[model samples]
Target: MRFEPRRHTSDDERILPLINVVFLLLIFFMLAGTLSAMDPFEITPPRSASSGEDNPRDIVVLVGADGRLALDGTPVAEADFEAALAAQLTESEGARVRLKADGHADATHVVALMERLRAAGVTRVLLLTIRDEA
Candidate 1:
């Protein structure tokens, strides 16, 4: 008696389950992604006594200890800082600005930056700091 060879089955039956798993993983990652505007420069901000809540979409301005200034991670001259801020504010009405200054930064430097923001029509400004750990 002659024995017939068995036909190999295609993997088409397993494709649907694999596709479903991949889709679910994609959705999970999308939802789990943390959305926050982070400063490009690493700064050790001064501690604050106030328990101010942080907004995710606020524009950030960083002032380094050496008086270097950056807005949204882009370095700008002291004279051009106001113009850059104005351009940003023009895009969003009533947009809030957050200032992140190094702990060792001079107080006067921070104050001057704040004044510039005010002059540029940013009415609301928030100072960013790390909350002290108990």
Candidate 2:
């Protein structure tokens, strides 16, 4: 009977390359997303509860602290805001709306805008508020 030595396969040798490749892809995507261009406008949503899952909204209406309105990131004049919103609502019946108001935005203005949107056939509106860390 002849006795032979068995080959030993090191698990780390196969896993090290996989880990290196994963890290390289992660770094690449992080850089790519950081450099990606989006709306030039700056908006910071108000924070409150941070636990619940958020519902999807079809249209976005942003209210800047200075009383400016942006429909889906495009600026809409005060006089034209309702018209634009109505048009969007009509396009999608019973449309779900999301209002992203700046943390410093006036409460009255936000309420007024909500009333106007309700009048414009937007029955379902979600006012987005950021979750508080505390």
Candidate 3:
């Protein structure tokens, strides 16, 4: 009696790699989607006895405790901030700016930023904050 070796069928050979690649792609997209761009730094807004409507479409300017700044969630360099901010608001003449300032961040810096926003032609600038108990 002679021993014979069996060869893999074409169906099995082709399908295995296809299934593996599909799974890999699925996992890749799942992770990529979950790992979207996050804010460069975290901030704790001050509390206030105030309430107002917030438009989700309104632009946000996040100010960190370390004097770091981000425009619409993207970090912006102080040197080019005027140009960058102007570029962002070029279309909207009366763009509403929402300032999210960290509780511990410099008040002077926050004011300065607000001034810059005003200079950039933002007519209405709202300082975002948590509401305190009345």
- Residue-level lDDT of model 1, residues 49-120, one tens digit each, is 677876757788999888888888888888888788888888777669999899999999899889878877
Q: List, residue by residue over 38-61, the lDDT tens digit for candidate 3.
A: 777998999999889977667788
Model 2, TM vs. native: 0.66
Model 3: what TM-score?
Answer: 0.70
> Which is the leading candidate under TM-score?
3
Structure candidate 3, residue pairs in collision: none
Once superposed on the true structure, which residue ranges of model 2 sit more than 4 Å away at CA? Answer: 1-37, 50-57
How well is each residue in 1-134 modelled by candidate 2, as lDDT tens digits? 99799978799987999999999999999998887435436778888875444444478888988888889778888999888887877776655898889989999999999999878877777888878888
Listed in order, each prediction's TM-score against the native is 0.70, 0.66, 0.70
| Candidate 1, run of 10 with poorest lDDT | 34-43
C-alpha-based local distance difference test score of model 1 = 0.84
Better of 2 and 3 by lDDT: 3
Q: Candidate 2: what lDDT?
A: 0.82
lDDT of 2 at 127: 80
Stretches > 4 Å off in candidate 1: 1-38
